[model samples]
Target: MLKYIMQLYKSKRLKVKHAFSSRQGGVSQPPYDSLNLAYHVGDRRDDVVKNHKLFAYEAGFDFKKLVFMNQIHSNKVHVVDEDSFLVPSCDALVTNLCDTPLMVMSADCAPVLFYDEVSKTVAAAHVGRKGAFGNIVKNVLDVMWERFGAEAENIVVAVGPNIKLCCYEVGEKEKSEAKNLGYGFALSGAHLDIDAIIAHQLQKEGVLKEHVEFLPHCTCCESERFFSYRAQGETGRNAAVIVLEDYV
Candidate 1:
């Protein structure tokens, strides 16, 4: 059984559940050693499957109900409904339906999990450099607002472990992109606070600042606990999953 390294905020009267897992307590190998959840990263297929199973079990979820995306790092937000249990080629996913576990994969990229108990909606987002620039966070908020009648004030967001500014060095071209977007000073060279940018975007979308929680752990700095693509080029992936189970 995989040990869950997760943080939880208690709330009654809602079935919402979520977790940001670290890269520990599983079976893989060196380079991609142990707890690698992504199957596309050249890890052993069987081990990957087992790892997924262990993760689901540990996180108190069913493996079959878990939904994943191809994570193109685009602004596309797929609204998951009955017929769309599995969406294709999307970076963000939202749903008013309950019991479906939504997930976003990342190494250095940000994993943002959102829950709006009032609207009975939940979402997971992958916010990388390109996705952030493309306004993926705003897109997800818009979808939640329109589809589930979600109030920005009622939404709770968690910014999971990701590459912090200390290690997210970028080239001139990437910096220029943010600059052109009117967010010129967001990136601080060889270091970018992508999580903070996403948080600001959430505020822009009317989500209250107090409703958002930022996890201060850096993937690159704490590579032993979480996978860091920037720290280890061509490496494994970690999962940040959220599922709304049946209310007891």
Candidate 2:
């Protein structure tokens, strides 16, 4: 029900609702200039909380049911239940329970949301290139499969908007990081496709290519719409959130 919203693939199957929010529809000011969902990005805490309330209202969830992480760009996945809301500092969250909204923040890093219709479980992950190098997607799949009885084949994934490869130019240092992880190849000039790397990891983990939907909105390129950390240093953060409601 959010004004600025993008639906995921098979969203209706889960009987839940979600949105990949853009830089529209909230109350932050220039530099952060509207709809910034992060508190640590130099925005006032009051504004951030107010923005969260507005976002929750628009996204069709109660503010109390929403949960956020401190996201450190690591491969850490938080297994969230009723008690998990109080703790922060993890980069990903998985919930089989209902009514709790799981969210991941990103300026350019990939925000991946997963749902298992058969099991009625949901998860959200923040996949920065560092996280990609850490194989965050693989870790998420492993946890979903191992803990929640979520079969990889039945796990529906939606990779939300992020910086694409064209504008996501990296240095040799980033390339080295990827190679050090033993995954992904280096181009001659040190550029890497973080999105491609994520997709490959998903497929390797057994998620069907068709089931994994990508938003394909490049944050850096589409500056008018989405936020980009690379392009706008210390700018606002766009959030990708999903929640299961009692009714569709």
Candidate 3:
């Protein structure tokens, strides 16, 4: 019984099935409690696997077909198919294969999902400060277009919950790096709006504003409903998953 928060753009688009999972209806106890979908965290492997199965079942996809990334906060985008499951050291995954889900795990880091209706391709990116600074969105879009024939305008982007500016404090070094990357400062030089930065990157990459949807709920602020690494130093992660529907 894994509960999910659906994205309207994904729901309306018939080519894909996508959901951003919340920290609810899971079996993990205490800190990881209820629906933690990541395995890297301290949550029990059995609980994480069960949670994945529950979420996959609820989202109308086979758990076995789900592919996950060993997110390292990098700009690496892995192109995947049925045989290319379980990628290591990649932050983004793209696939045109039907029934294969591309999933990204994040706590405070942003999870961005992409669906290209024209190409019938889907991708998920784990975007944090480093990835965003590295323009991971552009990298993903480039992969979708070059590798899968996806167009920027035809792609619907959904940015799931992450640590917002109100709660995301950054060091001066990070601030300098973000500023150098053209992502402006926030909170009187104390915070960085990584979400806004991601959105801006999407628009810069020629993705229409109307096609980009943002789930503005901050993970740090809404700790009860979503896991936040900033809020809880060592915590479980939420998942953003998308799959191309199998057509007979």
- Selected candidate, larger TM-score, 1 vs 2: 1
Per-residue lDDT of model 2, residues 1-248, tens digit only: 23544322223333458877888887788787678899989998888898888888877877887888999999998888766567567788988877888889999999989988877888899998888888888888888888888999998888888888778787777777777776555333556778788888988889988787787688999887888988888799999889876655
Give each model's whole-structure lDDT.
0.83, 0.81, 0.83
TM of each candidate vs. truth: 0.92, 0.90, 0.92
* Candidate numbers sorted by TM-score from highest down: 1, 3, 2
Better of 2 and 3 by TM-score: 3
Model 2 misplaced stretches (Cα beyond 4 Å): 1-15, 185-188
- After best superposition, candidate 1 residue 135: deviation in angstroms? 0.6
User: Which digits, one per residue and each the tens of the lDDT, describe model 3 over residues 50-151?
Assistant: 989888877778898788988888999999976667687899999888888888888989999898877888899999989989999999999999998898
Each prediction's number of clashing residue pairs: 2, 1, 2
What is candidate 1's lDDT per residue for 1-248, written digit by digit as tens?
45544322222322467777777767888677677888889999998888888888888888988899988879999988998876899999998777788989999899988888887889999999999999899889899998889999888888888899888888888878888996766777556778878888999888888888888889999997888998888778888888876675
Among all windows of 10 consecutive residues in model 3, the one with the lowest summed lDDT is 6-15
- Candidate 3 segments whose C-alpha is farther than 4 A from its true place: 1-15, 185-188
